[model samples]
Target: MNKSLAASVSPALYSSKTNTKIFTLTSAEHNIEVGNWKIDSTQLGILDTYFIIEQKILHGGKQEGSKIITLTSPNGLTITLSPTRGMSIINVIGQDMRFGWDSPVKEIVNPAFINLESRSGAGWLEGFNEMMVRCGFEWAGHPGLENGEMRTLHGKIGNTPASEVEIEINETAPYEIKIRGLIKESTFKKAELQTLAELSYTPGTHHFTIHDSLTNHADYPRDYQIMYHSNFSKPLLEKDAQFVAPIKEISPFNDYAQKGLSDWSAYLGPTKDFDEMVFNIVPFSKTDGSTIAALHNKDGSKGAAIEFNVKELPYLTLWKNTDTEKQGYVTGIEPGTNYAYAASIEREQGRIRQVKPGKTVHFKIKYSALMNKEAVNKVKKEITDIQGNQKTTIIQKPIAKE
Candidate 1:
């Protein structure tokens, strides 16, 4: 694959692969004093049996970009960082995941893919997340030609620049980490900001905010094709899970969306009843937590929940696995300004964020578990007032525009 293809998919935000290695990512005397938080890159490097981020550190794929970052836990959970740089996980110790996949066999050789016995606790992804504050994807494809069966990706990391990464820890508290990054091309050089933020869960009470500062560094003019790729396991999709946003429609990921990242001309059916999955940038009816996006399993034993204000994330990309030949465990619940191959659309509409040589751009995202109807009603009332009985266009829920 080309460099742009690799970099574009660097962080495998919604990947389903297996790796087993644990690298020691020790903590430093960090003193950013961002807030009451602990930044322990070492502990952060540890993963549960539940999930892992696809960093593309091992088993090469096509050269997607300059670097790639991935995370995985013993519990069969994974978050990939190709397009983005970081991820934030919550309440991990409670799930039983597939460990046989990420663990190594004692062949007693230097396995390129991953080695759990040599590294820390199979948390190389997290350690790498803090090792340096910058990197990109390089190559991506199947694990190997003859013997390798795993489809993997690879990239260069923090080795890109020199900047201080902060990690602080407090007993029974939410941990916070921060890193600074940059991207420079021929006529542009802009700073890329990222953070792994977490707030103590309060069941259905508290909300968490994620922030980033994206700058366009081109000397002349530039356009930023920004996308937020969020990943969660299949078990999270509960019967109550719904999608709500300011979307116009959803395009399916048929042969078109796959071959070209921006292709969305075809509308594939909901992947095996996974209606929350879409390929096009669909319209959402989210006023303040509208159910425009969803993933529910009616069975109700295992499920996922989501509640976000559409004002921040206007576009979304819902991905699910339907190929009988493929097997994976997670789906993508992405909220962003651009979808695959849809960057030019935002640029043409002047929605693209541009940055000059020393400029900065800031954006924020907040997520939390929703309460009962009363809480949703309260939010709805506030948003309703904000929208106010307007005789405006009424776009279909999660449907695309003409």
Candidate 2:
């Protein structure tokens, strides 16, 4: 048990009565591995007893060697994180609702068994059962060739394991719990990129935030793209479910999507052999550049939403795959620096972002579980206010160079 005092609390915010603790679950450099650990206020002299942080490793089939961290918040929100899979969130259970989809891939397949380049570069699908999975550090989009190199689907970050993971407790009033991981993607003479992924939540709240800082460790500049594929299904995603956002522009991603242009924002019941439809959107942001997108059930009573800074993530991708439940019926509300086109096409469209040597870019997003009509209505009003009087530009076809 290699526990240490964390210095995250500022002097002004630090209280003599509180004890801030940091638990190192996995750190190769520090030679620490506190396996199957759990902590609560009872062990820290804190008043909040409802919160718990637990870490364990799965040991069977493809999930073997995968490290899982479960954070049970005071508000009854439980988030399951997979450090072995780029710290992707596997489940968000709260408010008597589960926010993730039921994917055919039942196991949280460790990166060791995942072949990101298999199945025509779509092997990432084999381990894609997560509420939210990141799609890039180098390139994030459809699989395609770039300069004769095949860029696999959604890049390799999600399949890359985190080298270090730790749990930090804020001790002061609010008592925030944070799980941080260091994920890196690098190749000799090609690119060197890393991101400090942090997921934090205050006690007694239905909301949690993901704050990630990505840095280019290469001596030269590197191009990058990232998309947060936040997914939802059944209970929160029923037939006629509405994908709501304050849109500045919207367009179909391809001919298949164009056929569903009129019903793009509306979801359908799971059908046999239903192909997915993708839409590209530029969301309207508030004056400070903050924006939100939400998916509500048919009656708008139950929902889930994501808030992000549009300046950092300037695009939204709506992915509707209403296939039969057995085939994985789900939808994705993705926010990213670019649309999910092939990297080459995005580069031609001037959407691929870049970072200089030793420079880091920051991205922050908040995920909320809307438990009732009141909560869902509040978000709807926020989006309505952002829309003001602007008319959304709807394009019937893909705009990028495909």
Give me the candidate number with maximum lDDT: 2
Model 1, residue 313: displacement in angstroms?
A: 3.1
Candidate 2, superposed: residue stretches over 4 Å from native: 1-18
Would you estimate the TM-scores of all the predictions?
A: 0.44, 0.94
Model 2: worst 10 consecutive residues (lDDT sum): 1-10
Clash tally, candidates in order? 98, 0
Model 1 misplaced regions, further than 4 Å: 1-163, 169-209, 217-220, 237-248, 251-277, 282-294, 305-312, 324-326, 342-351, 367-402
Q: Write the per-residue lDDT of candidate 1 for residues 1-402, one digit (tens) a residue.
A: 111112222121212222212221211222211211222224445322122222222222322222333333232232222222233221222243111111111111112333322222222232222211211211111122223322122112212221222212221213221222222222213323322222222111233344554443334434343444444443343223333333354444344334423422222222453322346454444445443333323332332334444554466666553322123234455555554332333334444444455454444554433324444445444434443554324222422221
Cα-based lDDT for every prediction: 0.32, 0.87
